[model samples]
Target: MTRAMGRLLDDAAEGGRITPDEALLLYTDAPLHALGQAADVVRRRRYPDNIATYIIDRNINYTNVCVTACKFCAFYRAPGHKEGWTHSDEEILRRCGEAVELGATQIMLQGGHSPELGIEWYERIFAAIKASYPQLTLHSLGASEVVHIGRTSNLDHATVIARLHAAGLDSFAGAGAEILVERPRTAIAPLKEKGEVWLDVMATAHGLGVESTATFMMGTGETNAERIEHLRMIRDVQDRTGGFRSFIPWTYQPENNHLKGRTQATSLEYLRMVAVARLFFDNVNHLQGSWLTTGKDIGQLTLHYGADDLGSVMLEENVVSSAGARHRSNRTELIELIRGAGRIPAQRDTLYRHLAVHRDPAEDPVDDRVHSHVSSTALNLVPVAAAG
Candidate 1:
């Protein structure tokens, strides 16, 4: 590394923040390991506890009937397709029960944007789930979904968010934030909400006391500057509201998606993104390694690079898996992965509160149900009516 780059890394390690331009330069020019070392230093200093955390949650995909069909998604079927499916309230409640039985503390209710489904649809389901399983935090949906609901229901963003929050929605997930830069974001998800609009939704949500994580979907032929620009946008918002709890950057899955297998983020590229995000975001507290999309080896390496969390066991996940993500692990394996990385394993809740910290190997708890991979039996299970 050059003297200037080394100084930049050192400055970052010493708790100094770098400007977006400087970050872009380092993100593009800095050597991978050098950047990672500095990022790891920053992480160690910030999280002195040496506890790497993971969450036990289920991504309850309620339906796959989508209108904003992005190029990179292989999961959603367009509206009115013969193969579309929407789980009845009973089915959804059943899955919630399953997740709670397996010790899941969070539920991520993901689905496609159906015009027929307005805010009342979400309100009904979210209220039902909360009534049944008040222990489960509903960290589901994204800004785009908020926008879709607003348009469909003829409500403003704040009103829609207020209604959802009143119902049972706990927080927003950073879905549909592929590449927040206009050029690439429009290229991939042209029909989805704009990049700035995504942040606006978050800002409004944060204003109302609801917080969220900012997710990055890298390696879709975006320029390095655009990648850094995405982080810059999120950071600017973080500076204002301090509402973002974590920043998760994952690669684009290609196998079963519409973009085909043409583009992908290499393991090294993913690690570098993790390190850069750690260095750039001074305000965001957590950085999650995407074991679900990037594989466990790289995910484990992220603990050393700068990530404090290993994301979820995802009692069920269909979005990325539908697109070719093949990694899987149970709760036991996740704990071992953290311990193997020389950090204590702590299971966290939706709000990042530690539920259980495994400080001793002899005391590690094991469960058979906390595994990944949910097939698409319902994707083609036959079209069900949209949620009311």
Candidate 2:
């Protein structure tokens, strides 16, 4: 690393902020350890408790029928495809019941952009889930979904967000933000909303008091400069609204998708992005590493590279799985992974509150039902309420 880059990292490590240009310089040239070291410093400074958090939640893809055929995704089927399916509200509630029985505190309600399903469809689902499981946090949808729902319902993004929030939606999942840069997005998810439109929707959500996490799907042949530019865009929005709860960066899966086995980010590149994001997104508080997209080992290493949270013990994940992600973890093993990484293990709510902390492994709650794909409506024919 150059002397100037070392100085920048040092300043950032010591809680001093760096500009996006400076962040790019460090991201491109600084030694990997140096970048990680600075990010760890920032993480320690931000969270002094030395806790690494994870959430127990299920990704309930309400339907696979979509009109926006993103090339990088393998999960969606065309609206009229013979295989397309949408779950009934009763089935969705039953799935939520299974999740809650298995100790889930959050429900990620995501699906495709079906032209027939508008804001009312979502409102009905959200209302049902909230009515049945009032304790479960509804961290659902993303900016792209909002845009689709708005267009279909002849309403604006703000109106969509307002109705969803009033109907018990808690926050957005920040999905469909493949990359905030325009070129790659057009090249891949051409039918999706533009990068600016996605950000604008999130800003509107923040204005309406609905916070959301921001995410990036890297390694789809995006330039490193573009990666930094993505961070810059999120940072700028965060500076004004502070609505982004966390910044999650994951690699694009290639198998079973239109992108094919084209290109993807390496583990080192993922770590570097994690560190750079921690340094660049000073306004954003949490940095979550994707063990679901990457492997569990890489997820463990991210705690040292500035990730404060190791995403979810995803009870059911179909999007990335449809692409190529095969890694899975249960509650016990996830806690062990976090503890083995030298950080205390904690189960967090959607808002990052410590719902349960496993400070001592001996006292770790034994929930056999919390295994990977343990309780779901996606994988088995087991009755939803009787599955667990």
Could you tell me every candidate's TM-score relative to the true structure?
0.96, 0.96
> Candidate 2: which stretches are off by over 4 Å?
375-388
After superposition, the stretches of candidate 1 with alpha carbons farther than 4 Å from their true spots are 374-388
TM-score of decoy 2: 0.96
Which stretch of 10 consecutive residues in model 2 shows the poorest summed lDDT? 379-388
How much is the lDDT of residue 209 in candidate 2? Answer: 97
Query: Model 1: per-residue lDDT, tens digit, 111-227?
Result: 989867998999999999999999999999989999999999999999999999999999999887888999999888889888999999999999999999999999888988899
